[model samples]
Target chain A: MNLATKDIGQSLGRFVLTTLGVGMLLMVVMAMGGIYRGILEDATLLVNEIGTDLWIVQRDTRGPFAELSRVPPNLVHRALAVPGVKSSREFVFHTVQRERRGKPFRMAVLGLSWPSDKGDWIPLLAGRPLRQNHFEMIADASLKIGLGEKIQLGKETYTVVGVTHDMLASGGDGIGFFTTADAQAIQFDVPSEAVRLERSSRAARGTRFELAAKQPSLLEFANLPAAELPQIARPQVSAVMVSVLPGAEVQQVAKIISGWDDVSVFTRKGQRELLLEGTVEKVRRQIGLFRILLVVIAAVIMGLILYTMTLDKIHSIALLKLIGAPNSVILGMILQQALMLGALGYGIAFLAGRKLFPLFPKRVILADDDLLMLAGIVLAISVLASLMGIWKAMKVSPNEALA
Target chain B: MNTLPEANSTNSTNVSDEIACAIETKGVTKIYGSGNTEVVAMRDASMKVQRGEVVALLGPSGSGKSTFLTAVGLINPPTSGQVLIGGEMVLEGPVAHTNLRTFRRNHIGFVFQKSNLIPFLTAVENVQIAMELAGESRGAARRRALELMEYLGVADRASNLPSALSGGQQQRVAVARSLANRPSVILADEPTAALDGERGRQVMDLFAKVAHEQGAGVIVVTHDHRSLDVFDTIFEMEDGLMHRAKKP
Candidate 1:
């Protein structure tokens, strides 16, 4: 029998226990890697799902996901006027919290103009998209909101028209889609009392200015009906998402929009990169640090275990030496046992991670490529860890067998 | 059929052309430390044994009997000595004329007091590994191992691990392993020290049988004098010095 099989046979319980321990450590490593991948996946899901060719945001901003970007709602017209632009829609993005059944739920609220196919940004899993723009909303399936349920936001109650799957914002929050007019009313409409207070405060200030100038006409200007007064609060949108015509260059359209002084533009690729690297960079580094720490711990643990096992078998090693077995033979035995341990441990970790990762509160995406990469790393670690045992076995004197 | 090389004719001057010496040592010395703190473990030890001869080594504790056995086994090379196996000089005064590991694998076998079987392997595998190390095919090695186990009277226990075997059975497997490579000489250090008198005598007789039947020279270091009659010759060691004993 080969040394690895023989040694494992001799102490099956210890071998299994050690493998289980290493498996747990490897599970942490796999989970950490999955978390990093999950962050990247979540960061780009919205951008990928939207399938927009260009994003026009407030100038000097990194787009809606990375920074606060607000552009006038009228920017959609300008974006549509750009050459090669096939469709443009004003998109509003914000975070909101609502109490449902006495439980608080948070979600990203995305406002898109209707009658434009831009409402198809989120794929519906059940029910139909918003046919009426006034008080209908589509909720992410993760929010657990059922169809036909009414939810209150600000001063309005809206019916859940449809449910969508995997529609999440960069921060891993579920999304709710609303018509642009409803969203603007919910976001920008002030309470009637507050409006009255503002109007009175402005009229009093105007009266004081008129008395100082000895002209009562300024009060008339201030007393003008609220509708007759210039509309000071216009609808503001987070960004204008634009789609290019078939065969049209996306970069060309982005360049045309970039000429606007009030807004900057990003191609789809640039927006995806900004979402991944700029928005989730810290989380990636944190998960990376955790992954590195777990790997080092795994290597140290395997090294110590292999070294201890070698020390325990020093006599057998010396006997092998005395019997004229070459150093390569003994070294092969140690290396084989180490690799076997690593393989078994990785198998256990992979199975356990697959079963357990979904239960984690945060998104954990275990990709096939990540699994293969981790396997290679574990194999390399096993080989390097066995060196300590090999060194000790090599130093065993054959004469010790005679003693 | 065995593939081992025949003994050189030039080194068989004292024997018939057909009977060659299996092992010859000339003034082998093993010294530990140096100067005032130096200790001699073996001094000017010399001997010869023909093929198919079984020799017993008798000594008191700390008399360097193990030292001589290890030195002759090519494990602990002597500080100053020359060693020849099958009439070929393999070692001279701490230097080796060939790769010692390969030389030992082809020419020598060793059995220890404790049987020292690899606990994880069954009796057959323990024996088979020795042959495999000498470049035998796995099938051939396994066939040879079973043959040796049968010859050593442990064939029924061949599939059992060392832990499941009795003390005498373990020693039999160890002896079978020693014979696996078809070596010219076998060196056993206190091979019967852990057995009772009856079991010990049986193990010693097995060594004698192996030597005579396989045409191998055997040297066994032991404190048991009751089995001395099993050996063709007897040597005694005292305080690192060796001399021929008066044969009974």
Candidate 2:
């Protein structure tokens, strides 16, 4: 007669309910790990999918994701001049927030090197990538923008021509792809009133200069529309993405680019590390601490539960002892029950997670082998917890039954 | 071997009682605590029971009747004394001549006040476990359990749990369990306390029948006076001392 199983059978309803409560607690612990992985995947989605062999950013900065990066658009040409560099693309990234139906519509915007990189590499769920440079854009499915819908940002409206899924930035916002000119147009967009103020201010400045007063032609140049200006420098890009030739050495090409004074070059892997180590490090630690605390809490609860169960069996145990039931019988009983509880609880957590994980606001990615390690930990915990009950059981003198 | 109510099917020790003595205690004493906190629970108490005899140790609460019974039962060893079972010296003053637990399992049985059945086990399993603890094989143990259950008139309720049985039925099952190992000595402490008058009398009658028919020495410590006529001999205790009640 296996005493533990027999006892559990007698109070199956209570046993199942208790196991369910433990399973739910363990489920959160399991999901915590998946959520942390989801954050990592979200943080590096762009870096992994952009098909870049090298990233050229501003000197002394980690960007374009970990820190702000600004390099002149001509860096693409400079990178292409390297021996192993086969292709180069201009990269621009920023976030835009606009109003939609009285709610905030926030998207992490990326500018594709249009006509060369028309977002053909993007995994589209619907519609098509940017067909024209001026107004066509590709939006993530999470942005809630349907194909052919129009969204206005910065005094200009862009039509959503393509939709992608799970293409989120590190900050968990949806990403939209647009042409370099259009994205820059939105990034530097200013109100017409501010532009008017700027032109008048420039006309005043031109009149105040003694040289400008004598020439008067310089004043005519200043009064010309800001678009026709000749003294302004070209707008800078966030970074330059370089893809190496199939048979060439990437490190050799990177070594050549590293010699440049104004920019820093990084291999694709370094960029991903910067994003993971710098972007989401704290969130990972916070979730990791929570998982540890929860595991400790689970061990404590299991200990107390086993102790109380043994306490409840005092009378019967005393009687069994008096009848010459050995210490082995009592020890076997408590140990077996603890293992059953741990094994069954893990099963419930996994079965329950399968039904509920997808409903979470973030992705929860759990694989089967995760249970192998967790099950070992749970089994060890069960044995340690059952020791408390076994200790209490061994002290019960058979003489108590005579009382 | 005759089955059910004969009580002879399960034991090799079920022989005529003429030549063997079952239980004998000489000057047994049990003390608790030490120094200023020292208290004596049983003092110089002695009793003898022959094979096939039923004896009752009657006393008020705290009168050492239970102390003497536990000492002879080899559970709470006495501070000073000799305890013999089946004509063999087993205990001498808080010490044992053999492995106490194994010796007890093979030789003695116990039934408690509340019918102390393991709640999770069904009626038959409860009886079967006692023999299993004595190293009996599961098949043989189960067969004997069923025989004892039938003999105790509880075989019909073999599948029912202890909680589903009434107080009287529970005590009957407890008796069947005590008989499972075919012990030479059966000790009971207030075995019928939970039952009504008629049920209590019936249980007392069952103890006497087990003693006379099975040739096992039986000792019952109880305050129930309604069935004193059922015992073959009676001992009384007061303040750690024992006195045989003189025959009327």
Candidate 3:
């Protein structure tokens, strides 16, 4: 027994190589699992961290991220005075393609009248919050925007003044914050041809003649300047975020707010469940399948390695048994080798995962708990892999040495 | 009567029997296959070897000499027989205890036709492994291995691999491994069959010396009769039956 252990230790190189191979495979599986969990977490983190207690959106809509939910922006004023309601802020969202230098990047525009950095709405990582009403913007850091870089928003250009972390919309597009008026313009402003077509159709319908008759009388009496043309004709907002006073019952407020004929309210916890249960459900299933496949492939690789090791020592095992070496000794040798291989493979994969995972586009969390779970899974596979070799080794008759 | 050639050859104080036999087998038989294809490998074979005696088993092919040796060595189970080692009945048919592995490790030693030393282990380590497998502590096993190697005159080649040594030296190492656990009996199956004439005789002489000086019962299965004088007793097998020939 003592001599056997020394011999095994002396051949350390072979064992180490086998371990590294297995560990690398385990690392990939682990990273995939962690990244999947991270993506789901990031999606919901944006909603959960906000100080809002309830949301008001159009009926039959799955919030802003999963689907379009549009409502009149003025609905915020009505909800603010509802029973148990403390304050309300209107949030307008739209996706737009913008050019930074020569490259085109898709960014989500979020327009807020109140400062986006206030309350629990945004966590800023660098620079100051938006102070001026025009031209200044704050973008999610994932968008690769540097402070003070000019970002083209439609025909207008805005200066990036600050950056925020965890400020992203449902579609994985980073939220770019601006004044409400700018967001409405980008979302609903029609092109010249569409505007001209609308005007011609109105003229053909004879409605312009009545408006012209009434316009001169109004203009002569008030000498009024032209009303600021509503840049957006739709003028619809996706939802409103509401924050309640301390010790207030959010569910009661939500029920009161739901009484509105045109809008419905969703509590913070309800929205989180919808995101996980509805928004990313398909992606989660796909990742689950990937995880299952990875485990099976890992098992196969381990089995092949164990089988190969056993084959290499077929004759040695026979001779050992012939010399009255116990079945336990032979069995122990095979299992120890398998476990060593698994451990080595896991270590190498972990280091490789840490070094390489960040380079990937998707989030790869590699959390400590996930790693421990992965190690446990790998150990189970290692034991399973050795079963075949152990069975074969123990069955080797001492008579084989004679033959 | 069991041969006691010299005063220093036998020690009877600690052991109950005066002339302790290294190996004793009675009515040993082994059958392979069954029914339509039953093959009787050995039949009613019996032999007794006292301490400090070297015996050679001689036979033609298919004469069951190897089977008889294996049965007595405890490497193979017999169909029906009683096998005694150091005056204790250890096996009736097969070993009755679940701890047969430990029993074989401590009570039996084997040397093969090809030396069969583990390729990865050096000469000394090869011997030490046998002792280790028998559950001896590492320090004690190594110390005993070194002592055995020196006694066998292979201490100078202890560090060399089996492949690096000559056939004679490798056989000497195999002998050292066989004696590592201090078993009462040592079984050698055609140990010198692969060697040339000079090396074969040298191995036989070593076995004879180990039997005489170490007070072990040594059984050598061989076809070569040129070195017959080296053995104290000769047993020949024909048609799976053993017949005792003249004592050397």
Per-residue alpha-carbon lDDT of model 2 for B1-248, expressed as tens digits? Answer: 22465466333254452446789999999999999999999999988998778999899999998888889999989999899999899999988998888778788988888998989999999999999888889998888888888877888999999999999889989988888777789999999988999999989999987877777889999889889999989999999999899533
DockQ of 3: 0.47
lDDT of 3 by residue, A231-269 (tens): 324477878888887888887788777777777788888
Model 2 per-residue lDDT at A97: 87
Per-residue alpha-carbon lDDT of candidate 1 for residues A327-391, written as tens digits (9 for 90 to 100): 99899999999999999999999999989998876688889999999999999999999999999
A1-403: candidate 2 lDDT, tens digit per residue? 7789999999999899989987897788778867877888888889999969999999989989999999989888888888988999999999988789999888888999978899999999998877887898999988899999998888889999999998998888889999998888889889999887888889898888999878988877766665588686577899999999999988888889889898898899999999888989998789878878888898899899888889988777888888889989988999999999988988898899889987876777685565676777788888998999999899999887766
**What TM-score does candidate 1 reach?**
0.90
Cα deviation of A206 in candidate 3 (Å)? 5.8
| iRMSD in angstroms, per model | 1.2, 1.0, 2.6
RMSD of each: 4.2, 2.8, 4.3
Ranking of all predicted structures according to lDDT, beginning with the best and ending with the worst: 2, 1, 3
Which is the leading candidate under lDDT?
A: 2
Task: Write one digit per residue (lDDT tens) for candidate 3, span B159-218.
Answer: 887779888889989988887776678898899999999989989988887776667889
In order, what lDDT does every prediction score? 0.86, 0.87, 0.77
Higher-TM-score candidate of 1 and 2: 2
